[model samples]
Target chain A: MAPSTTTTYTTKQWILASKPTGAPVLSGPDATFKLQTVTLPPLKDGQLLCKVRHFSNDTGLRNFIQSTVAPERFYVPTVPVGSPMRSGIIAEVLESASPSYKAGDLVMDFHLGTWSELVVLEAATSQKLAPLPKNLSLTHYLGAFGASGLAAYTGLKFAGGAKPGDTVVISAAAGATGSMAIQIAIHLLGAKRVVGIAGSDEKCAWVQDQLGAHACVNYKSPTFVEDLKAATPEEVDVYFDNVGGHVLDAMLTRVKKHGTIAVCGAVSGYNSDEPMALRNWFELISMRINIKGFIMLDYMDKAPGILQELIGAVADGRIKLQDAETMVEARIEEQPEVWMRLFSGKNQGKLITNLIV
Target chain B: MAPSTTTTYTTKQWILASKPTGAPVLSGPDATFKLQTVTLPPLKDGQLLCKVRHFSNDTGLRNFIQSTVAPERFYVPTVPVGSPMRSGIIAEVLESASPSYKAGDLVMDFHLGTWSELVVLEAATSQKLAPLPKNLSLTHYLGAFGASGLAAYTGLKFAGGAKPGDTVVISAAAGATGSMAIQIAIHLLGAKRVVGIAGSDEKCAWVQDQLGAHACVNYKSPTFVEDLKAATPEEVDVYFDNVGGHVLDAMLTRVKKHGTIAVCGAVSGYNSDEPMALRNWFELISMRINIKGFIMLDYMDKAPGILQELIGAVADGRIKLQDAETMVEARIEEQPEVWMRLFSGKNQGKLITNLIV
Candidate 1:
C-alpha cells in the first residue's frame, strides 16, 4: 500500500493503566491498558514516520511491564506505568524525515510499539527491509529471520555446543523459538534425531510432518511421558527449553551425562504468581549437566549475518519455515486478543497479527 | 610401630549386614554391619600383606553401601549387602610379593576397606610413601595429601575455575576436604577473600585463625543467614558447596553473575532418607550461574602431581594442615562409632583412626 493521502495523522495506543496483579489484563473493567488517541508531532532529522503493517504478538512485553525487578534478575528496563506497550512490527516508511528511507519502503522495528497504528522510529532502531514478493513474507522478518531465529542459532552454538550427530529435544515445539530450534537442529546443525514437545496433538503432527522433526509429543496428552520416552531412544544431548516448569524437571531426569540445557524462555512461569519449584535440581550434580539462560539482545551483533543465512536457506528451500508461521488479520484494537492466543495455546507456530486491510 | 609379628595373624572385619533403613545403625540390634574373623593368607605374586596403621574415617563409604542406585545417578559401584565398607588409609607393608613395595614401607590406600585390623592390597592399588621426617604426618596423607586434597584442587581448577583475587566461599570448612579447599583457595589459587562455613563456632575460629580464611561463619548459629550476608559483602564469586539443602538455597541467592557452585560434596543430604528440596532453582538462570558436581576419581591421572604440590606447600609453611588432623585410637571394633562422629558433628577436621598400638 502507498502512504496515506491525508496531510494530518493520528494514532490509537494502549498505555499501561496499573501494575499487574498476577497476570496482565487484556480486557474488561480491570484491563491494564487504557486506550488513547494522540496527534503526531513534527518529525526530527534521522527519523521516519511508519505505519505498522504486521506486528508479532509476543511474550517479550510481559517481562518488562512488571512493577519492579531486582537488578540482577532482569535484562531490560521496566516499562513505565503510563507508557505504550512495545513489540516487533513490519511497517511502511511513510513521509520519511531521514534520507536513508523513502515513502512506501518497508522496514522492521524489532522493539518499537505497534499498539499505535502510526509510529515515529529513530534511524538507529529501524531496519530497512526488501519489500514483498522479493522477500518470503513480511512476517518472516519478525518470526524466522528475526530475534527468534537468532536465539535458536546462538543458544545452540554457544550454550549447547550443538554438533553433528547430536540428539536434541525441544520444548514448546509449536511456538516461535522452539519451532525454529527444531528446524535449525535438524536441517542446519545435522542433528541425528530431533524430538519436539508441543501442546496439542494437531500441533505435534504439524511439528513432526511439516517442520521435519523426527518425533513430536503432545505435552497435554495423558501418555505424554511415555511418548517422550519412546521418541528418544537415545538420551538427550541438548535440551532446548522454551516452556520451563515440569518439562525442565522431566528433561532433568532424561539428559545424557554432560548434556546441555539451553533455557530460551520460561513461558510456563512468566504469568504465574509463583513460578514452579523444580525438585530435581540434584540431577544437575548427578548428571553433570550444564543449563544456561539467554536473552536475544545479547546476540544482536551476530543477528544480521544469521538473518541473511536464514533468508538464503529459505530462498534455496534448504529450511522450511512457511508452514510453521501462523498469522491473523487484526487491527490495532485487536492486539490484546491476538496476544491472548499465546496463553490459550490457540495460536500455532509464530503468531503474527496483520494490520494491513 | 612395627609390623604385627604373628605367623598366623587373625583379622577382625565389619561386613555389611543389611541395607540402611535411613542412616546406618551402629552397634544396635538393627546394625548394618556384622563382625567377621579371618586368618591372614600368604601374599600372592602381585599382592602385599599390609598392617593397617591409620585409616581415614570419611563419608565415601556412605554412598556405596546403599542397596541400589540408579545407573545414571551414580558414578561408583554399589557395595553388595555382604561386602566390606572401604575408605582411605595409611598402612605399613608387612610382606610383599611385588617388586614395587617391600616390608615396613608406608602406603596410602584410597579405597581399601580398613574395617579390618589386617588386610591384603593389590600392588596396583597400593601407593608407597616416603618414610617419617621426609613426610609431614602420616595422617596428612589421609587428610590433605590424599583423595580429599585432590577433590579441593581439581574442583576449584576445573569446575569453579578458581583464579587470583576470586572471592571463594567454602562450606564444611573444618572438615578434611573443606579445610584443604581453604588453603588451596588462598595459597595456591590466590583467592583474595575466602569465607568459610563450618558447623560450630570453634570450627569457624579454626577455619579463620588457623586455615587463614578471611572470615568464617557458623552455620549452626541462630543468625547464620545474616552472618553469611555480612561475611560476603562483596558477594560470592565461587561457592564450594560441601553441604547442600538450605545452605545451597541460601548461597543460590548470593552468587554474583556468572559465579560457580562447585558441588564437591552434599554432606547435609548424605544420610537422610529423603534429600532436602531446593526451591531457589530459578537463580541458576537469573544469575547465569554454573553449578557442577565432581568426584576425585575422575581426575586420578592428575592426582599424583597435585599431591606432590600439596606436600611441598605444607612443608614450606605456605599451607597448614597440622591443626586439622583429628586422630582416634581404637581396635577394629570401634569403626562404626568413629564413623558416627562425622554425622553427630563430634569429629572435627580430618578424623583418622590410628591402629599403631
Candidate 2:
C-alpha cells in the first residue's frame, strides 16, 4: 500500500441534528443527524490530518445522550446536539506537523467524530499505533486493543478488583468491552469462574466458546434469575455491569460480601424517559458491595500499558479478538441506520463503520 | 453499704406477654406480662446470680416479635410469650460460683431482662465493673461505656474510615449510639466537623452542646434537605447512619466522593411493614461511595480496646456522656408501659427501668 499525501479534500460528514428521545429512531423529531459536505479542517502546528478507516458505535455514546435527561443528577451534560458525534476510530496519518508521527504512520485517535472520511486531530490526542502482530487484523486493534480494551482492563483492575480464583460476571458479555473483561479476568487474572449474561442463546454460546467464559446464561430466558443463581452458586465476586437494568438488580442480589460492581454503561435505560428502578440497591449496604461508575476518559494515563498488555495477550493467543466487521461503503445518508443497528443487538461484536475501502 | 449474703430472696418478675399490634401497648391481646413469683434458678458452677439494678430499653428489642427478620438484625428479640424478656443490664453479683468474679461485685451483663429482680448469667458474659470513679457515675458506664460506646468506636474506626480532618455526620444524634458516635468523632478522632441529624430541635441542640457536634439539624423540618445542604456544603465524609429511611436517602445525595457510610441501624424502617424506598442510590456508583451495614457484634474482638479508649475518654472528660435517664421504679406488671415509652420517643436518653433504689 502506497502512502498518501496530506491533501485538503472535501468529504461528507454527519452532524448531530437533534437530541434523541426514547429508543432513538433512524430519522425522527428526536434526532436528525444530517450529512453535509465540508472542507477538511487544516491541521495545526502540533496536529495531524488522518483518514479514518474504522469508526466505533458503542453503548457509551447512547448513555451520553440520556445522562442529559436529569442534568442535576449527572456531573456533566450527556451529549449536545449540533456537534460532531463522539466516537473512537482507527485512522492512518496522511499529514503530520508534530514530532510524534510522520505522513505514513497509523494511529488510534479518539478525535473520532469520524462519521467522516478525514479528521484533523491534535498530536497530543492522536496515539501512534504499534504494528499489528502477525495473524492479527487491523480491525482487531480498533475493537479489542483500542479504547474498549483499555476500558475493560482498567474497569476490572481498579473497580472490579480482579483477583485469582474470583468469580466475575459480565453483562453484555458478547460486546467488545464485556468480552475483553471476561478474557482479562480468566486469562490474565486467573479467575476460577467467568460467567457471561448475554441477551440471546447465540451470544451465550459465543461468550462461553469464543471469549473463554466458564459459563454463559441468556438473560432473556424467563428463568434468568434461577439460571444465574445456579451458575454462580458462590455468588459473583466482581460484576462488570454494562447493560444495567434488571440484570444489574439481579446481579446485586447475588453479589458476595465485599464484592465490587464496575458500572461501565447502562444500555438498558439509555434511551428511556424513565430510568430503570434498581430495586435491589439496598443489597449494596447489607453485602458491603462497592459499585463504582466510571468513564474511560478519566484513565487516559493507563492507556499505553493496557494496549501493550492486550496486544501481547492477543499475539500469545491468551485473548481472542472477535471483530464483528460490517463494512458500510454507502453514502452518508445511511449513517443513522448503521448506528441504530447496534441498539437492535444485530452486531455480534464491535460494530465498526468502514468509511472507505 | 454492706452486701447481703442471702441469695434466696423472692421477687416478682414479668414474663413476655402476647406480642402487640402496630405500637406495642402495655396490655397485650394474649396476656399482659403476668406477675410471676417463682423460686430463683440455681446458679451454675461458672455462673453468677445477678440482681438486676437497671434494664435498658432500645429500639432493637422490637424485632423479636417479627420472626421473619434475621436474628442478626437486632440486639435482642422481645421475650417469647411466657418467657422472660431478654435485655442488657447493670447488676450486682449476689452469689457467685465462678473464679472470674466475687460476690457483691458490680458487673455489666447482656442478660438485662431486668423486668425481674434477679437473673443468672455465665461468668464469660459478665464484665466486672471497676470501682466506679468518684467523678464518674455507675449509670454513665452502663450508658456510654457499655455497648453504645463500643458501637461508636467500631463504627468510626472500621466502617466510617474516620480520619482526623474528615467530616462525620451521625443520624439519630440524640440517641444512645448516635450521641456516643458524635463524641468519638469529635473528641477521639478529631474530626474537622461533626454534624448531627436528630428528630427534634431540642435534641439537635443537645447534640451540638453536650456531644460536641460542630452543628446539628432537625430532620423534621420541612427544609431539611436545604438545611442539611447549607450545614454540610463540603459534603459528608463519614455518615454513621442509625435512622435509615429518609435520613439515609438524603445523606446519600450529599455524600462526597470516596465517602464511607456506616449503616448502623434502620430504626425508621424497623416498624414499617413496607421497606423504605431509596431512589437516589445511583449516586453510590457515581461518587464511589462505600456504604456498609454493620452490627457491633460482628466486631466483638475489638471490644476490650474500645472499652479502654472510651472509658479513658469519659474519665478524662474529653468525651461527655449525656444520660437521658427516664427513671421508672415500678412493679413488674408496669413493664409493658415502660417498654411502650421507648416507641413513643418520650424517653430522652437511655430508657432504664431501675429495679433497685
Candidate 3:
C-alpha cells in the first residue's frame, strides 16, 4: 500500500545558521537563517509522512532566534545554531503505518522542530482533527480554533472571569490571539461592550467590523488617549494585555475599580531591547486592579474540554469564523521573508506560508 | 441618666485653615491647622459624653488636611477648611444616655470629627472593649489589637494566601501595620522565613531583635539592594507592600513566580506629589505576581470575626505583640508637633498622643 509520492523527498528547511544580534536575516550569505536541502527517511511502522500544508509564523519565534534565551521568561529552550527553526503547521498524512492516522487525514502540530515540506511525524505528535460539522476551513484551526483560541478562552475565563454584560477591552485586537479574544468576550462570554486597541486604522477597522467588536481605537492616531477615553465611557471591566507598553498604562487609567487585567503576551515589546516602562501603576492602588499572567501551556490538562467548547461554539455559529490571515502561496525558500514581515506590521492577523505552492 | 459629667464642657479642636501645597505646616499662625475652643452641648438621649484618652496619628490623616481631595482615594470625605480634622481614639465614657454605654467603660472609635479633650459620641459609633481575659493594656486596642492588626490579618489571608513554610517579605516593618504584618506572617501563618525592610538602623534592630523578624534590612544603607538579596535567599513567596516606590520596584524583580504582593499602603509616596514611577513591572508577567490593594474599610463586615482571632493569638502569645509605639504625653495644643513627627520618622511603630497629660 505505497502512496503516490516518491521514495525520496527533497525538503528545503530554514535553520538558525547564526544567532541574531538584532533582527535575523532570513536569506543570503550573512543571514541568521540559512536554507538547507535534505532527504527524508523512509516512513517506518507507527509513523506517518505528513506534508506541511501551511506554516504558522508567530511572535514566540522571535525569542528563540537569539544566541541564548535562558533568562528571558520564554519557558522554552533557545534554538541552537545550525538547528531547524521550530514551527506549527496544518499537515496532511499522505502515508500512514499506524491505526491512529490514515491517508487523507488532516492534522496540526504546534511544536515541530523542522520547517521542511515533508515531515515524518510520530503517531503521538499531532492532533487528528475531528470531522468539521460546519463548512470551516482547516486554516481556522491555526487562527481561531487552535492554540490562540484556547488561550483566549481559558485565559479570559480564569484571569478576568468577565461576567455577562461586563465591559472587556483587548489590545492587538486584529492579531491572532486578540481577534479570538474579542470574539469570545462578545459572543461566547456575552460581553455588553468590547473595545479594542490596535496600531493602525485598518487594523482597528478590521477589529470593529469583521470581528464585530463594539469599538476599536488606533493607537497610532494623534489623539489616541482622548479617543480611548471617549470610546470606553463605561470604563473597562476586563482588559486583555496582548501587547505590553504604554498602551497598558492608558488602560490602567480607564479600568474600573476592582477590574481584572489578563497578561496574555507582550508582542509589542518582543522585538525591542528597551521596552518603555509603564508610568500609571498607581492606578492599581486606587482602582484595585487584579492582573494574572498565563499561557496556553498552563491549561494543557483541560485542552480537550476547551477544544470541544470551541468547536461547539463555531458550529452553533456563536463564534463566526473570520478570515483574519495573510497566507502567502510561496515556496519553502520564502519563509524567512514572510516571517520577517511580522515585525514591520506588513502582514495581517496570522501569517502563514502555503507550502503547496 | 447622666452620671458624673457637667451639662457643658470646654474642648479644644484642630481645624484646617488652608490647603498644603507640599508639606503641611502644623503649628504657629502660618499653620494650615488652627486651634479652636468650643463648649460642648449636653449629651442627647442615645449619646455618651466621653473624655478622650488617646489620639491616633496616622498616614491617612495627610490625605485629609488638604483643601480638596476629590481623587486621592482616602475613601472618606476630605476635611473642609474650618472643619475639625478627623481622628481615631481610645476614650473613657464619663456619662451614659443609653443601655450600651456605662460610666467607666472603655471604647475605641476609628472615625471621629473632633480631636477635643472632651466630647460626645453616638452610642452606635464606637466599639465598647470586651473585658480583657488577659493582662493586655487598653493601649493594645490602638496598636496590636486595632485597625492595623485587622488589616494585616485579613489582607494576607485573602490576598497572598500563603501556606506553611512560605517566605514573606514586608516593607515599613517598624511602622503600625507593618509591625503587625511581620508577626502574623511568622506566627499565625507559619511562614518559614520572614524578612523586614525599614528605613533606619534603629528600626531595623527593632524589627530583628524586638519584633523577632528572621532578618531586617535597612533601606537607608548604601548596600540596601545587596543586603535585601542576601536576606531573601529563598526568594519571596509573599510580599506585604506597606511602602510603595523604589522598594516595590526592587521586590518586583526578586519575587518568585506566582508570588503575591498585598498592597496594604503606599507610605513612601503619600506625601510626594511626584511619586517615583515603577520600572520593573515587567517582572509581574515573568513572575506571575498577584497584587491586591486593600484598606480596613473593605472588610468592616468581617471585622468582628477578624478581631476575635487577633485577640486570641495575642492572648495565647502566638503573636508576641511587641512594644512598638512612640507615645507622647503632651498638652492638647502640642498635638500638631507630635503628629508632624511621623513624617520625619521620629516616632516608632504607632504614634499616639496621650491626652490625659
Evaluate all candidate structures by whole-model CA lDDT and list the values in order: 0.79, 0.74, 0.78
Can you write out model 2's per-residue Cα lDDT over B121-151, one digit (the tens) per residue? Answer: 7888677778655466676656677777777
How well is each residue in A54-135 modelled by candidate 2, as lDDT tens digits?
7777766665554432344454344567766666777788888899889888777665445777778888877777668876
Q: Model 3 over residues B138-254: C-alpha lDDT tens digits?
A: 777777778778778877777677778999999989988889888888888888999999999989999889888999998878998899989998788889887778888778776
Over the full model, what C-alpha lDDT does candidate 3 score relative to the true structure? Answer: 0.78
Using DockQ as the measure, which candidate wins?
1
Worst 10-residue lDDT window for candidate 1 chain B reads B67-76
lDDT assessment of candidate 1 = 0.79
Better of 1 and 2 by DockQ: 1
- The residue pairs found clashing in candidate 3 are none
- Please tell me which predicted candidate would have the highest TM-score against the true structure: 1
**What lDDT is reached at residue B106 by model 3?**
85
TM-score of 3: 0.81
lDDT tens digits, residue span A1-357, model 1: 998654777898878777676678877788878778988776889888988888787875676676223545556555677888778888888889888999998888865655778998887778888643455777787888887888888887776778999999999888888888898898788899999999989989988888899999888888876788788787899998888777776787777778888877777766676635554555666667777766666777888787777777777777787667888888778887787778887677788888854
**Model 2 TM-score?**
0.80
Residue A173 C-alpha lDDT in model 3: 85
Candidate 3 or 1, higher DockQ: 1
